[model samples]
Target: MNSSYDSLVDLFLKSLRAEKNASQNTVSAYANDLNQFFIFLQEHYRKKADGIELEVLSHYDIRSFLAYLHRAGYNKSSVARKLAALRKFYRFLNKEKLIANNPLFFINSPKKDKKLPRYLEEKQIEQLLALPDCSTPLGLRDRAMLETFYASGIRVSELVGLDLPQINLDLGYMVVYGKGAKERVVPLGSFAIEALQNYLRRGRPVLLATQNNDALFLNYKGVRISVRGVRLTVEKYVRRLADSLKISPHSLRHTFATHLMERGADLRVVQELLGHVSMATTQVYTHVTTSKMKEVYDKTHPRA
Candidate 1:
């Protein structure tokens, strides 16, 4: 790797971790995204990765890199994300006085298509959650995790980051540390609370064979369950019911938000519960529940 590029990449990621308090996942994604651009720069200029000097690159050079991505058959969304990563890296260079010119000034990101998030019907969610056998230790943990996913509407990262100290079963709330280390207290339903209590009493202790681990969910190794493990656990049941719809832990989070909006939960409130940094992020659910919103309007509004 080039001396300048390596230092700048390290600094950028350090800033992401220290200044923004970005999660490990975010750091890893940004590293991957930026490294991909580095590889593109190497290949485009017919130079080794360490030979490409980003500061000397032109606007056309950057645009060509983007063009290369398009030619490589990257999807619009993926390309946009890569572009975003590139833009941020350039901005970091600008801020650090490392570059003479900002090549991204002339570039614009492609417009993103509006795509509604996929969510399961209430019955589908019920069936999916019910598929876990709660009688066994692993089954109890899986049940609790699913219940919490639906009840809290948290990101998968937040789910796996949970510890015993963060949850308040008696108070029926949990402190979720979200993106940028922002904290929000989310309420839990009776079902989730009961599942958690049952798991804590019956399932967790049995799985708690290894000492000194504080994670709320554990695997057979008595280690904290990983995000992949959580996905696989969700997929096991999703596959049984996976006829037409796509379902994952993310789908469960989407289902939580959609169901809340369908039941007339306030948009801002849902935003807070979900720990979304912006109301605009939560507004997509309004679009998803357009039919339900229309039903409410038709039933209540005199004009309808």
Candidate 2:
């Protein structure tokens, strides 16, 4: 890209980090989306990106870009995400007076299909948790991780980001830094607390060895475990329990929320627990529970 485009993109990304507290993954996604848009502009205009000013771009250009994405085989969700990224970028530009107005301000996003989040059955969760052998260091750690996931409906990123000070075993709660660097306290269940205590006292030390890392979870090399490491550990145990299960650590999060909703937990409370900024995002679990109730009614109701 040319210097002008690079400068604007960098400035916008910096704002996302400094102002919005966007994560690295989020910033990178915005960057990728903006770069793709600029490339499309270059190809459409048959000139370098330096010649295409943000001021001259209209809603038609934005619509054309969406059309191009669709033609290039982008799905509705993918197109929607790209459009969202562009919308944000353009909004930032307008705020900074780099553009007179946001071209995407009036554009509509494609509707995304409503797909229910996958969750484990209570029996399956119990079986998966029991699969980890507590006697072994890795097993104890795995048990704690699994317990924590089911106890707190945090994202996988928040789970892997946990540090020693974040967890309070005595109080049965943990501090979580969720999206946008928002902080929330999530309660840990008795089972999770016990598992965590065991890991901290026995498993973690054995894994830590001589390492001075302050991470709550560590890899075999005695360092902080990566997100990929946690996924692999979960996958290993999941495969043993059921080869066709096809669930990730995230499924445990869904299970946590679903179980709570089934037990009459309030929607607003669940939203706070899940650290969802919008109640709309947490509303999906309602559909999950409602569907389950319908299934149970169909089976148990004599009149039906």
Candidate 3:
């Protein structure tokens, strides 16, 4: 391509890599989005736009780009992500004084509906955990996995990425690496600790074919378990429970947070345990718990 375009791409990528410390997946996503933006500009403007000079693009251009995406049959979520990438890029440019204003600041993003997360009741959680028969080696591993998910309230991504060294069995705590590579230590409940101990002693070694010693949880094939595998295993156990309580692995996370709040755990502490970047995100669990309490009060009170 043109030297100016090449230089801008390189500069932006270097900023993301060196300054932002973006993960490989994040960098790849940004590159893909920006590349699409460049192609759209080339086709619409009829002149090949290049470099940081293109960073001076107007709200009109951005609107047209978004319109083009919609017309090209892109889903709302994909369109939203593309707009987000553009906004981030423009903010970076404005921060560096490469632009007088952010065009994205003027353009309105499409509204996205908030979908409430599904969560299990305390009884359902108990039933699901008990569903795993700890008599067999695989059963012990599955039991430990489910217990850890509920006890720690960790994301499936964080859970699957856990290493053996991160667990402090004696102390009943585990360190989780979350988004942006931020690390937080979360306490494991007694049940999770017991399950993990059983897995470590009787189950994990049976799964290991070689000295694959890094992962905290492993599949039957002795490899580090994947996020999908974890989800599937959780699904399998949830299905064993009544069909009324259909749940995913993330549901366990929600249940963990909500149950903690219902039990009067501090909001900030729950935020820290969940590794939420903002307490506001963690505060939603309080609302969920409150709604349940209100339902109970309405049902029991007879002051008609």
Best by TM-score: 2
TM-score, candidate 2, is 0.70
Worst 10 residues of 3 by lDDT: 46-55
Candidate 3 Cα outliers beyond 4 Å, as residue runs:
1-105, 244-246
Q: Write the per-residue lDDT of candidate 2 for residues 1-304, one digit (tens) a residue.
A: 8789889899999999999999999999999999999899888975455524677777998899999999999999999999999888877887888767677878999999898998899999999999898999988999999999999988888988899999999999999999999999999999999999999999999999565677898888778888999899989988998899878988888999999999899999999999998999999999999998999999999986
Pairs of residues at least 3 apart in sequence or in different chains that clash in candidate 2 = none
- Candidate 1: C-alpha lDDT: 0.87
lDDT (tens digit, per residue) of candidate 3 on 68-101:
9999999888999999888887777667776666
TM-score for model 1? 0.68
Report how far residue 39 has shifted in candidate 3, in Å: 20
Q: Over 4 Å off in model 2, which ranges?
A: 1-75, 78-106
Clash numbers, per candidate: 0, 0, 0
TM-score of 3: 0.68
Model 2 lDDT at residue 175? 98
- Which is better, 2 or 3, measured by lDDT? 2
Order of the predicted models by lDDT, top scorer first: 2, 1, 3
